[model samples]
Target: MRVPVELDPDVDDEAPTGDTITVYDKRHYVTYLRLLDAKAEGADWKEVAQTVLHRDPVADEFRTRRCWQSHLQRAQWLSREGYRKILEQAVANKL
Candidate 1:
């Protein structure tokens, strides 16, 4: 079953991938931060899926779960690898 997700108008809801980097990661910086905060607080994937990803968990449990997990993992990576570069680039652009 394909999960029907209603992406938040303010968020950049690109498909999560196994690739080490993605353009959406840079675009959705604040979304990644929110995901990181949720993970830090030990939030459940179901909650994150519905709230953050706008996924209907009950409609397609597997896809919803996978979506939340993959995006959350990508969010972790964004915090470690990508975010610093974004900050540096922002500072550089200012100079």
Candidate 2:
């Protein structure tokens, strides 16, 4: 999707707590899909971080790993809980 890798420093590392969809979630939908796929295929985090998430592991190992892990966790959360709200939003938008 050629999505930009400009991670917002202000956004929390954790996913939204409630059944609410945020602009960040909407923007990173493709990213979430990529993450979910990578995880299901057992792809290495280093590869996923640099290739998918576009973070340089060599420059900052800790931040790169943390970002990858946090985002993957959030993606999993979205699959389990957040997609319902997003579906509702889509239905509302169509109406």
Q: Whose TM-score is greatest here?
A: 2
Taking the tens digit of each residue's C-alpha lDDT, what string does model 1 give over 50-80? Answer: 8877787899898778777777777887667
User: Judged by lDDT, which candidate is best?
Assistant: 2
Model 2 scores worst on lDDT over the 10 consecutive residues at 1-10
Q: Least accurate stretch of 10 residues (summed lDDT) in model 1?
A: 1-10
- Put down candidate 2 lDDT per residue, 54-90, tens digits, no spaces: 7878998898888888888878889998888878877
lDDT of 2 at 85: 82
How well does candidate 2 score on lDDT at residue 42?
Answer: 93
Q: Per-candidate RMSD vs. true structure?
A: 7.3, 5.0
Off by over 4 Å in 1: 1-23
How many clashes in candidate 1?
0
TM-score of 2: 0.76
